[model samples]
Structures are given as structure tokens and as C-alpha cells.
Target: MATHVLIIGGGIAGLNAAKSLGDAAGITVTIVDRQNHHLFQPLLYQVAMAGLSPADIAAPIRSILSGFSNIHVLQGEARSIKLDCACVEFDFGVLHYDYLVIACGATHSYFGHAEWEEFAPGLKTVAQATEIRRRVLAAFEQAERIEEPDEQKKYLTFVIVGGGPTGVELAGAIGEMSRYTLARDFRRINPRLTRVILVEAGPRILPMFSEEQAGRAARDLEKLGVQIWTSSIVTNVDANGVEMGDERIQTATALWAAGTEASEIGRSNGMPVDGRGRVIVEPDLSIADHSNVFVAGDQACFTHQTDRPLQGTAPVALQQGRFIGKTIVQELSGKPRTQFQFFDKGQMATIGRSRAIVEIGRFKFAGWFAWVTWLIVHIYYLTGFKNRFFVVLQWAWSYMTFRRGARLIVEKEWRMNQLESEEMLVDTTDDMPR
Candidate 1:
């Protein structure tokens, strides 16, 4: 019988794994995902800041796997994994498989406070990114219409919690947008007066990086008018704003870039999982006692090769997914499955235009050169030729003009209702006896 491989998720890991097995003659692959597209998550911040449209950083999954006739893409959510039966149950139905690969990835985590999510949305999906962009742009517009300085100040103050790469990137982009992008457009309330604050619970921002690198990033942010509040733990978050310890900042827009937990799918089937709910897989990226079932990407806790489990970075996911793919092929060919080992390609994070920090082994660098390196690396990893071409074109234009093109606010609550109505009308007409 031919081997049927079922892969959950269409993210970097899942896509890479399916590709690795695409040419294998006897293996058939099925990719299941909630969304039809694969998102370039690193650039999601750019979307939230309206620097790039969603399509620029995303591509349909079908298009990506069209070259492989053996691979099929299904648009649906996997409800649960039935390990005992070696089958996956979807919202629509269930499918049994010879091999299962789980790479559902992670989602926005509110720590212990789920209520905070209403006030501060994290950038995990395209919908959330666009919602943030609307809130940000609307804040400026609301400030312009208001007469009270206090009310206007409330609209202008923006607070970003967490000092990780996501927080730093978000704060920097907003700072630039306020000081440059919307500065000339707003006449009533000066966009330059918009206050951008970054709150970190740790001693410093970018805690994952070296102290020297972290300190440099902090300084670079200050230059862009971003106020970094270190060692400030948020006690409460509401519609009004957020309360960080004893200090309280009244702001209209509060963005969360704090932490992420494994997606709901990761917390399933009574499988052994870590604190973050990621599946604890064997050294070969397979579940214990069930080598046929594997886990990769943000859904797996792999600590065999290192003292600690690997962080859920793109490079880590890519390596894990690719290794699993190759290992499956080897097992089919009667070769032993080797343990997965991640080759650290180093880490880098961009501050703003012409400013970034990079660490690659002994080589440590920051400034414009590091920023250029960051750009080249990201451009290289983008999915399609069209994406790379347009991204480069847009980056060139933005660098030269200091402006973003995808700054339109079209998905507000009322606007979405109108769209829903239009869709209903179209559906009703299609149902007419014609």
C-alpha cells in the first residue's frame, strides 16, 4: 500500500516537510490548514504598521504546492488528533493516515490575563495585523476631531508591552510612522507628538540577545523617540489603557508582543506537553512509542541536542521540518532515522530603517550594514519570485520616499457588516431558480 502522510498546518515547517516528500514516488501528502495561504510571519509587523499589504507577505498554499501532484492542500481546521487510531478528525470529517506530522504552530498568549487581549492584540495572523493597523490609524483621526487636549493625548499615547523582537520592531515602526509617514498628513494634531512607549517586564529589552546588543538596541530606540520602560510588569489592562506596576499610562492603543503559547491543537490528545503546551517529541521529532507520528515547528519541545528546548524561530522550524521530511524518506528506504540537530544560523533583529543588530558566531555587528544584511536574508526566504520582486521594489521605494502604500483602513466593524450584507445578497441571487 502507498504511504499516506498527513501534515497539519501550512506554515514554514509544514510546507518544507511536504516539499521534501513531494518527489517520493510511493508517498502521498495532504496539507490541512485553517487558512489557504502561507504567511511570512517575520514581516507580519510590517503589515500591522501598514508598511506592506497582506498579499505582499503571503501566498496561497495551493499555488505553492501546485508543482507536486502527489501533494494535496485542504482548507479546514483539524479538530483533534486521534493517536490511538492514527487518524485526524477535522471539523468536516476524519482521515486516517500511515504517517502524521503536526506543525500547527503557536498563537498569541495573554499570560494569565485573557481579558487583556481585547485591549492589546498581538500580531499572529493577517486579521489581527489589519485590526491593529485600523486601531492605530483611527487613533490619529480621532485625535484630530477632538477638542480636549487630555482626550487627544489619550488617543496619541501608544503603549507596547514586551521588549522582545516583536515589541521592538513594532515600537520602531510606529515611531517612524508618527515622526515621518503621517507627520505632514495631519494638520490638527501633530503626528510627531504621538507618544510611543515600549514596556518590558525584564531588566532590559531583547533579553534573548547579549547585554551589549540589547543595550545598543535600547539606545537606537531612544533616538527614534521611543520610551523604553524596563522591569515594568503590567498589572491590569482595560479599554482605557494599561497599568504597569505602580505607574499607569492612559492610552487608546495598547499592543501586546509579550508571549505566545502553542495553538489549541497542540494541547490535545492527552499527549505529553511542556508548560507552553508543545508536544514533547523524541529525538527524531516523533512522539514516543509512535515513531510514525511526528511533530515539528512551534508545536514540538525538542531538547535532545541542547540544554534547553529550541526557541520557536523560523530557522529552528525550517531545520526541524526539513530534517523530519528527510528522515521519513530514509526510514522508507530501510535506513535508520537520525536524530534532528538544528544548525544555529545566528540571530538578528531590525530596529528601524538603516538600523539593526546581528550576531553570527564571533562576528557581532550593528548599524546600517547589519540592517542591509537583515533585509537581504529576509528577501531570500520570502516564498515566491513575485513576492521577492515586489518586496524589493516596495523596500526600495519606501527607503527612498519614507512612505508606505498599504495604509488604507477598509475593515472596520461597520465596514465588515456592510461587506457581509453584500456577500449575502450575492449568495441569495445565486440561489434563485436560474
Candidate 2:
């Protein structure tokens, strides 16, 4: 009988693993995910910033793995994993497997402030990106109608917490959008009136990057008119805005790019996990005491090759996915499983128009050339041909015209729970920019 392999999640790691195992002999793969499509998470910031639509970064899972006859795709959220029985329970039914790869990915971490999610949602999936876009565009629209300058300032200001790649990227994009894209679109709201503040608790933004690279990125963002507030910790997040220590920055929109924790599955099975709730896996990426079950993507805490656990980047996940699939193949062949070692492909982040930073081993560079490199690299990594084509075309047009075409306010209700707490009803009406 063929070895049945069950894989969860359709993100970079899971999908890559599914693709690797799809055609293997004596093996049948089953992939189950909460969403039907695979999301290109690295560029999800682009979607959140209105640079790209949701469809531009996501592709149907069925089409992605259609060429594989031995692979089965199911769209169902897993309720729990029954390791004892080698099965996963979904709301619809239960599916058993000879080998299991858990890759449920991760979600946004609000630190200890669970109440802040309603006011400030992080970028992860298409829904959260669209919701963020709505908040930004609607804030501009709301500012256009307000008569009082103070009220308009509140609406015009956008605060982003966390100065990592996501925070920096979002802040820079919003700054460019408000200054260039929507600058001429609105008559009442002056381009100079818009404010984007990036708050980071660390002493420097992009703490992972070298001091020189982080400095360059900070300068680039400042050139785009984004306020860089380092060493600032947010004490509170309310509907009005965020409070840092004794200071309160009043704004209508606050975005959280702070931190991420693994999906609930990591802790649900009683496996040992890191502080971020990522499953502590063996050198082969399998959990201790359960060699048949392996974990990948943002769900696994792999520290074998490095002092720190690998960052939940797309590249790491891609490598882990391929490694896990091959490991399973090795297991089936009665061969030894190789220890997973991540290839450090380096890191890159775009600050705004014609500004970016790239680090590869000893080589490090920033500015226009670096930006082009970043662009080409992203376009090359996107899943489908159609997605890549459209994204390239859109970016080219944006580069020339300074316009983000996907400025849609489809969802008006930006803060549902916060509004509920405040006893207010938000008009989450879908509309286009005037």
C-alpha cells in the first residue's frame, strides 16, 4: 500500500512540500487548509498598501497542484490532530495518514493586548490586507468631508507599530501613496497634512539587519516623509489611537506589524514549543517522541544550524517544506533522514520609490540598484505566471505614474469590536477614491 502523507496549510512551506511529494512513487499526498488558495505572504504588504489586489498575490491550490495525480486537495480547517490514531479531525470528517506534516503557519501577535486587534490588524492573509486597505482609504475619504482641521488630522494620520520589514514597508508605502498617489486626488486634504509614524520598541528599526543597512532604510523612509520613532513602546491602543508611555498619538488608523506566534496547532498537541509557540523540532524537523510527524513553516522552531530560531520568512519555509518532503521519501526507502540546514539567501526590504537594501553574505547594498534587485527577485518568486505578469505590469505603471491602481475601500468597518466597545456603528461602506 502507498504511504499516505497528510499536509496542513497551503502557505509557502506546505504547498512546496505538497508539490515535492505529488509525483513520488508509493506515496499519496493529501493537503488540507482553511483557505482554498495559496497566499504569497512576502508581498502581502503590497496588498495591504493598495499596491496590489488580493488576487495578485493568491492562487487557487487546486490549480497549483493539478498536474499531480497522486495528490488530493481538501478545503477544510483542522479541528485537532489525533497523533495516537495518526488522523486529523476536521469539522466535516477525519482523515488518517501514514506520515503527517503540520504547517499551519502563524498569526499576528499583539503582545499582551488582545483588545487591540480590532483597532489595529496585522497583515497575514488577503482578508487582513483588504481590511487594512479599507481603513487607509476610508481614513482619507473621511478626512475629505470633515470641516475641523483637528478632526481631519486625526483621520489623515496613520500609525504603524513595529519597525521590522513589514512596518517599514507599510510606512513607506503609505507615505508614498498619500504624497504621490492621492496627493492630487484630494483637494481638501493637502499632501503635506498626511502623517505616517512608525513606532518601534527597539533602539533601531530592522533590528535583524546590520546598523548600516537599518540606517539607510530609516533615511529612505524619512525621505518619503514617514516619521521614524525608535525606542518607543506602545502602552495602549484605543479607537482614538495609541499611547506610548505618557504620549498619545491620536489617529483613526493604527496598524500592527509587531510580532507573530505560531498557529494554535503547535500547542494543541502538547508538543514542546518555543516562546513564540513554534513546535521544537529535531534536527530533521520532526517533533520529539513522534518521528512520523514533522513540522514546517512558521509553525516550527528550528535552531539546529543557528543560535536563534529561523525567522518565519518565505525562503526558510520553502527550504523546510522541500526538506520534509524528501525526508519522508527517505523514510519510505529505509534511508537515514538528513538534518535540515537553511541556506541563508540573505535579506532584502524596499523602503519606497527607488530605495531598498539587500544583504547576501559579505555583499550589502542599498538604493536604486538594490530596489531593482528586490523587484526582480520578488517577481521571480511569485507562484503563477499570470500573477507575476500582472504584478510586473502594475509595478511598472506605478513606477512611471506614481499611482496605486487598487485603492479600493470595499470594507468600511475597519474596527468592529472597538466600535462595539465604544458603542458606535462604523459605516463600512464600499467605495472608490474620489
Could you give candidate 2's per-residue lDDT for residues 62-129 as a string of tens digits?
Answer: 99999999999999999989888889999779999999999999999988789999999999989899
Instruction: Give every collision pair in model 1.
Output: none
Q: Give the TM-score comparing model 2 with the true structure, all chains together.
A: 0.94
How far does residue 254 in candidate 2 sit from its true spot (Å)? 0.3
Alpha-carbon TM-score of each model against the true structure: 0.95, 0.94
Candidate 1 residues 329-381, lDDT tens each?
A: 88999999888889998999999999999999878899999999999999999
Cα TM-score of candidate 1: 0.95
lDDT of 2 at 375: 96
On TM-score, the candidate that comes out on top is: 1
Query: Which ranges of candidate 2 are over 4 A from the true structure?
Result: 412-434
- Native-to-model Cα distance after best TM-score fit, residue 232 in candidate 1, in Å: 0.7
